[model samples]
Target chain A: MVKTNKQKAGNIITALLLIILGAFMFLPIYLTIVMSLKPQEELFIFPPKLYTLRPTLDNFSSMFDILDNNRVPFSRYLFNSIAVTFTVTFSQCVFVSMGAFVLAKCRFPFSKLINSVIVTSLLYQSNVIYIMQYAVMSKMGIIDNPLALILPSIASPMGLFLMKQSISQMPDSIIESAKIDGAGLFRICWQIVIPNQKPALMTLIIFAFQASWNMQGGSLVFQEQYKTLPTVITQISTTGIARAGETMAASVFMLIPPVIVFMLTQSQVIDTMAHSGIKR
Target chain B: MDKLKKLWCDVRKNRDCYLMLAPFMILFVIFTIVPVIMSLPVGFTNFNMAQPPEFVGFDNYINLFLSDKVFTKAIRVTIIFAVITGPVSYMICFLLAWLIDGLPKKLRSIFTLIFYIPSMANVYTVWKIIFSGDMNGWLNSTLIEWGFIQSPVQWLTDSRYVLGVTITVQLWLSLGAGFLALSAGFRNIDRNLYEVAYIEGMDSKLQELVYIVIPSMKPQMLFAGVMQIVSSFTAGTVAQELVGFPSTDYKAHTIMTHAYDYGWVRWEMGYASAICTVLFIAMYVCNKVISRLFKE
Candidate 1:
């Protein structure tokens, strides 16, 4: 009876700790939801209420109205985000996985040099190269096109390194057996290695989706039609505090897709990290 | 000559491997590799977008060091930002992930989703409302109601409190991919190691973590370390978003924002390239130092 009480006490303490941490983690999100649902009158109330007695959909509707009133319709920005995100994610999955397989399994002259370059590139953020990249893009005649976005993200060094780390764990003997059975290297990569890396692919999808979804043209693509959802949201929100409720609602809209993708695939992603080992 | 011939033959033998690599490598070289290579020469010149680049050889670099007070301030701010956010966020990530490790799987995923949402969602615009400068802002209104302050505090605009607010939001958003990797690292530990640890007279969870968990988690930890260091160093976008660009008196100016100011806004492509080159070198050096620390 005493031992049972001790166990119960421990469980309660753990629950309390988790709730506190969870509250901290969830605070900003909770504030966002409440602020979005608030009407303009309630939004400015002194000692701002955490719980609202009167909630409304006016903010979301106004957000739509504000977006719809723009010269380019709201759907264009939405389409650009979705299309770019899908292209980047799909291409990264296909091209990066293949590159990772070759880098991991096949040995050729200067392979060590190549591998080190890829690893070093992991530390190279895009900020350092943004100007030079614009030059290259202009030279390539892709400055105003969506290709400027899709083409650069295809060779994600982090993705390649991550996929390589996971692929490296494949036993050499399995590849040897496949080689003995006359499987081509391409066949071996697509069939043997790629099929088993679903978890890693899902994780990459989450990352690539977030990044590509958030890709603002910001002088890269000047075409109004090609502008992404984030650029539009920022443009609208920065107008003033008058549209504060609508701004929150729009951000909530922006937040939904990635959250859905993460919810669906997080368990698998955790599993991949377990297997990938990500170490030296 | 014989060894060279053998190497050529081996290269030919791996022709299929080269074929598989060609598509991605072509794009990688064109986009990433060439830009990086060009930044070096470009940094030496005085290039405006319209005029051809005139080689001014070290003038920009010298100006940045000797005359540019903002650049120096940028360096100081970036260092402080990195020093504070990098290790603190890193420890928070590890601690939270460690604590959340053994929860029921459904509950675990829910908590993970809650924590991970901010970084993934790009919901920073919401912070603008919360920290709005006037009485209507949530924080100010609440504080005023509670008799904390008589008037509104300009959280975003005020120079004194700007960096602190940025840091707070940064900490909120900092539990990113590194957090995910660390949490997954805990789950992947061999269960038998703990049994052996206890049998070998490890009396507490703390000892087991030190002797068994951390050593085995070196790889994930290294990856997370590289990630945290990289993110902390380039943390510009958040500050730019929360506070306006060329923020009040340039209070939240960072190395990245400095690069942006010169490169994009000022149209000083060459000068901007120089700034970026400096930042690149600093990051490379820091990464080397970090990897060496992680070396077993």
Candidate 2:
């Protein structure tokens, strides 16, 4: 009876602790949702009300109106974001899987060197190279074009590493048997490799998509037509404190897609990480 | 002639593999490798996108080290932020993952999402709202209602509090990939090992964790450690994003912000590159130490 009581007390303590941590973690998100729904007058109130009895979509509607009035419509930025994200994600998945397959399956001269180089590149600070990236992008005339974002993202070494880790875990006999059947490298990659790597591929898609979505474009794509959704959100939000409501709404919109992608792929991602375990 | 023929034969034998790797290597070399190489030389030049670069050897590095007061402050702030956030968040991730590991799958995933959402929803506006300096701000409003304070505190602006506030936000956001990795690490631990440890008189959960769990999760821990270090060092943006750029008297200035100030704002490419080089070296050295510590 005493042991049962102790266990019950422990369970309650654990539950209480988790609930508190969860609430703390969810605070900013909760605030964002409430602030977005707030009417303008309620936004500036002292000892602010956490919830409003009368909520409105006025902020979002106004933000959309403002975006619609810009030289490049708000829809263009959204479309650009979706297009750039999908293009980069799809292309990177294909290229990374191919490169990863070569590294994982084939025995070749200088393969170790190549693998180490790819790994080391993960540690290299890309912020340091943003200037050069811009310089090259300008020289190549890809500036002010969405391809500037897509093309650079295709070279993502992390994607290649992730795919490489996934592919290396495959049994050697599968490839050997495929080779016995006279299946070419492309055939094996498409028919066997990619089909089996769905989890890694899903994780890669979420990562690439989120990264492309968050891309700032820096000085590369300066044209209003080419700017992505995040660029537009930051620009509008940074204007002033008066449009705090609209900024909250914009943040909510920006937050949705990644959350949706995560919800869809999180189980697969967790599975991949479990197996991968940060192993080289 | 013989060597050339041998090389050609080797290449021909691996034609399919080379063919598969072609597209990625081409883009990687052009966009990644070349750009990194180009950035190095820019450290030695005085180029402001408006004019051609002039070779100026070590002046940027010298000025940054000797005369830049803000640069020193940036270093101090960055180190403080890194030292606090890196280990605290890492331990938090590990501990929470341990606690949550025994929960039912549905509940576990829900908790994970709740914890992970902060990182995903890292919008500047949300933080701005939460840490706003007015009485209407969430923190201030709560504090006032509770009578903890008589007036609103400048959480974001006041240098005394900015670093702490930024660190808190950073710790919230720091439950990122490392957290996910550690959670998965805990889940993947062999259940039988715990049973065996228990039978062998591992009396406390602490003993089990120290003896079996941590040792077994070394790779994940190392990966998480290196990642935490890397993430913390580059986390200059959070302060800038949250507290407004160049936060009051440069209190929240970090190495990354310092670099950004020079590189983007001041248009001093050479000096900025030097700052970045220092940051890169710092990250590299820390990574080396972590890898060594985790070496079996």
Candidate 3:
């Protein structure tokens, strides 16, 4: 009876600790949602209300109005973000997978050098090459193009590394048998390797999508006309009239696509991370 | 006929793979490699975007190191931020992971999702609201209502508090991937090791954790540490925004923002490149030392 009581006390303590931590994690999100619903007057009310007294869509409507008046087409920015994200994600998966396959299966000369370079690049952040990236983009006259953002970010050494790790785990005899059957590198990679790499591909897709979607610096560089959603949302929230609710609304909108992508690919991402020991 | 057949087979076999890879390589060279190389030469010039670059070899690097006060402050700030936040955040994440490891699977997943949502949410905007200078600010209002403070604190504008706020946010936003990775590591531990320890009458806590947990989580911990270091070094955006430009007497300016100021706003490409090179070397050396120490 005493032991059971001790166990019960321990369980309660554990539950309380988790609940507190969980609240800390959820506070910002909850506040944002509440702020988005509250009117401007209610926003600044002393002793800050936890829930909206009167929920309204005025904040959402005003955000749109502001966008319209400023000649900043929010839809265009959203579309550009979506387009760039999908294009970059899709391309990165294909390229990274191919490179991974080649490195894993193909016995090419200078493979070690290539692998080293890829690893170095993976560890290196864009800030290291910021000056060069800007200069080259200017020289190429692609400063304001979406390609400037999409093209550079797609050369993902991390993706290649993940693919290599995934592909290396495959039975070597399978590739050897394919080679014996007169399967060339390309045929073997496509027919045998890619189909077998569904988990890695899905993980890559999630990572690529998240990276592209959350990309702030790269998108900030080029394409003034074709502003990505993050830039647009940031600009709106920071520079414009200080409507807290509208800013929250914009943030909420900006967050939805990645959340959807995360939900769709969550299981795959978790599974891949478990098996392959890759973290994004 | 043999040559024709060989060519046909090659085309049939390698085309898809090449096509799949072409986009990445082409894009990488154009955006990444070319730009990196291009930036190197800029370090030798004094060219603003409006004017042609005039060669002034080593001048930028010399000025940055010897004369640029902002550059020095940036380096200091970045190092300090990284030094403080990197280890603390890692510990917090690991602790969270450890705590969650004790939960039931279904409850653990729910908690994990909740913990990770803050990271996924629009961080910049949320922070802006939380730290809003107005009395309506959630943090300020709450504190005032609770009588914790007599007056509102200028959390964002005050230079002393800015870095702290930035680090706190960093800790909050940094919980997801590292925690998830460690949790996964915990889940994958060999149950037999713990069983053996228990049979040997080893204490439950030490048996389950020190013996079974830490050893199994070495790889995950290493990966998380390396990633945290890289991110902490590069991540000054929150600080940049919160502290405002010029960094409130240059206290909050990190190497990244300084590089941006020189490269973009001032168009001093050479100077920016020099700073970037310094940052890269510093980060590389740090990564090397950490990796050697951990030896993962």
Question: TM-score, each model?
Answer: 0.89, 0.87, 0.79
Angstrom error of the Cα, residue B73, model 3: value is: 3.0
**Which tens-of-lDDT digit does each residue in A168-220 have in candidate 1?**
65668778888999998889898877766665566567778788887777677
Clashing pairs in 3: A132-B39, A144-A223
Per-residue alpha-carbon lDDT of candidate 2 for residues B145-179, written as tens digits (9 for 90 to 100):
99999988989999899989889888988887667
Number of the top-ranking candidate, with TM-score as the measure: 1
Model 3 stretches with alpha carbons more than 4 Å out: A1-18, A65-79, A101-108, A122-131, A134-146, A162-203, A214-228, A238-241, A269-280, B1-23, B95-109, B176-222, B294-296
Best-to-worst DockQ order: 1, 2, 3
Candidates' C-alpha lDDT: 0.80, 0.79, 0.71
In terms of docking quality, model 1 is acceptable
TM-score of 2: 0.87
Model 2 C-alpha lDDT per residue in residues A83-112, reported as the tens digit of each score? 998898889988988998999889876678
- Range of the 10 consecutive residues with the lowest summed lDDT in candidate 1 chain A: A271-280
Instruction: Give the lDDT of residue A6 in candidate 1.
Output: 56
Go through the candidates in order and give each one's DockQ. 0.47, 0.43, 0.34
